[model samples]
Target chain A: MKKKAIIYGVSLGPGDPDLITLKGLKILQEADKIYYPGSLFKSGLKSSYSLSILEHYKLDTTKFEGFYLEMDLTRVKVNELYDLTFEKIIEDYNKDLKIAIVSEGDVNTFSSFSYLLEKIKKENFNVKLIPGITSFALAAAENLAPLCLQNEKLIILPRVQTETELEEALTHFNTVVLMKIKTVMNVINNVLSKGNYSIYYSEKLGTTHQFITSNLEEINKRDIPYFSLITIKK
Target chain B: MKKKAIIYGVSLGPGDPDLITLKGLKILQEADKIYYPGSLFKSGLKSSYSLSILEHYKLDTTKFEGFYLEMDLTRVKVNELYDLTFEKIIEDYNKDLKIAIVSEGDVNTFSSFSYLLEKIKKENFNVKLIPGITSFALAAAENLAPLCLQNEKLIILPRVQTETELEEALTHFNTVVLMKIKTVMNVINNVLSKGNYSIYYSEKLGTTHQFITSNLEEINKRDIPYFSLITIKK
Candidate 1:
């Protein structure tokens, strides 16, 4: 009988190649194949932050195969994407190969791994996750700031969330991290100004083009990228 | 001109030795001295999970010195601890030695690093932080679950927070992570039962004695350690 393949959902950490956990690297190195998110592939593997990490460590990627998984959440039906990915994963598993689905930041947080994991649990293949540093945590480190104090709360909301949701979160939590802040720059600026909160913004954390600012005015004036994150403390 | 020393606040990730980022490990290996939280020293470094990680990775600790910094937030005056630690750090910096203040999980999350940073900001020494995988995130990974949906909010609150604060948080956020769960387990259990939330609990994550369970009843029947964490989905 052939051994069933396994899936390791790996979190690559916040954009820095060096930040990938040793266990994450070990799992990637030993895996039969590594699958990267479609977003990273579009940027090219040579320049991709995660792939750069493997190169920096002088790991032998030649022996392991790499694959790209496309994710168009807005346009594609979510279930279809899950089904296709699950099929692809099981096919590789049937061949007795260990597969890794690599995502930026921790695998369980707003990650593509979730979609696949949700669909694949009924299958016979073994699945596990390796966590990594989160982007908001990295942003806090970059600013030399704490996400929260004792008895305080932190709220993390995606950019696609309603402006009302953002405002409510800011009012309730000690620190609020708004992820993917490209389109809501003005809305966030307004909230920060009205709430009298300390604002820190960062885009593509740990990358060469990474941008960060504590100046609320500068953030309002600048063109925030789709990958930008804003942390507010009231 | 005499060079100034610096301190690196290293996030050691959850309990797993292999989970420490490569950058974190590199800094730890190269630091002239390493400072561990007083709580861990009381527990003994030989048995401490973080030290075990270094040993597991075969990093030579003999060449580098280790210092213990006392921190009893509940019993002692917090400022006095901060003042003493700041003085010790500056003395090391004056000798032009790189020092690392190691903390479990992310340094910016309810970490002692915050107090030190607040006290030592005006000093001549440089300070930087290295982010790590959080126990709550690791617990999510261990359960093969996601912390939140695309736009769902996540709340992280320490145990000292009042029961009212937790209830307020549960009403506001889609998911809530309660840290230091030993004292508040009953309150949390009551909340879970009332709110109809899905609960996942883990203690000493990544350690040999680590225990995790999705069954709320199992958790209620047992003695929850001070290091325990619970992630709830409402």
Candidate 2:
């Protein structure tokens, strides 16, 4: 039986190329065209950490297209990029070509796939999202950390805007997972010193330069990357 | 260099055998023994949904061991099962055999690994947790729904006991993910009728008996499974 022509969005998982699920791997292979996100530099060439993971698999490069997502988060710019990306996807969809949209982490998580999905809904496009492993899961796994246990509340916040927010989570939840802490490290540092807690930190996980640590001082000594995450457990 | 022998805990994703990460698959194949969890019926036979997913891959059954975990959550019984399981793992560890402890979803997320991990800490065991695709991720992916987005708080609660708590999350966070909703269908059903919010419900995801829907009424029509989950999005 022939599978119907449609668009599929797959998560590559975090870092290690081998983390990609068999279902995601199969969709990537079967798709006629694969679209992935990348940051376009001033030189007009794009570089994508997500694409670099694919290098391990060494999939056919001819079928892949990189959507140059700029670093600026201006609403107009962001909307334009996704809108244009959808335009190209619709073209392929109209031709009955199978399309795969690739994202770095779980497509359901805070990833580019969400923006694309919103556009997909408006057009009534046939799309399937293949779930992938989340970075936080891998980060906790590598460190032998429990994300949350029986009756434990897990709050995954993108930012710890204030010390109060961090403190509230620390007090109320059994475990707090804070992501993209590069800019809000101060709030975390203050709360850490004020309480008795265990810290597990990972940056650029699954890559060659990956860093993992339990010592807060060790992490404080270095510049935290945007991909860095910490599980503050009590 | 050959990968060194260690006790590895790998998540089998939710239901689909193919949803297991490539790394998890490789570890399971190479392990000297693979241990999974299930219930031992009065008939002296065991049934495990996690192991059933493995049947799709059709790995060697001889290498598998099913630990009988009672339906009861008594701490004494729970401790006994994991303690004995760890004892055997240690026996294999002493023999320098590579071992894999299998769980259904992400090992880091509210699974038996946390209980086993507590036991491992008593003795220095060379162990690694290989994260797997989470069922919630699969649930969201299937519905083209976003678990969370920029600056949105994502609260994952095993129980939403009160209407106030559910309302709080839906009001503050962009998305609230509730797992194991089988027991709390009444509370959910109450909120569904009161609000104009969107609901994405999933049960036995990626399995033959999988149920998924955005319609709250359709869910009320059937008996909710224990594995069911819901995401209330405002």
Instruction: For residues A1-234, write the lDDT of model 1, one tens digit per residue.
Output: 557478899888878888999999888888887766543233444334455545565556663443344333453555555566667777788888878878888888887678778766867468889998889999999988799766677888777346677777766678988887787666776666676778888887888989999998787777777668988888
Instruction: Report i-RMS for every model.
Output: 1.0, 0.9
Clashing pairs in 1: none
Against the unseen true structure, what C-alpha lDDT does each candidate score? 0.76, 0.85
For candidate 2, the TM-score is 0.95
- Predicted candidate 1 versus true structure: per-residue lDDT over B39-111, tens digit per residue: 3234554334445455665655663333344444443655665677678777778888888888878899877
Q: Cα RMSD to native, each candidate? A: 3.3, 2.2
Q: State the DockQ, from 0 to 1, for candidate 2.
A: 0.85
What is candidate 1's CA lDDT for residue A73?
42
Consecutive 10-residue window with the lowest summed lDDT within model 2 chain A: A1-10
As for candidate 2, its clashing pairs are none
Chain B TM-score list for all models: 0.85, 0.94
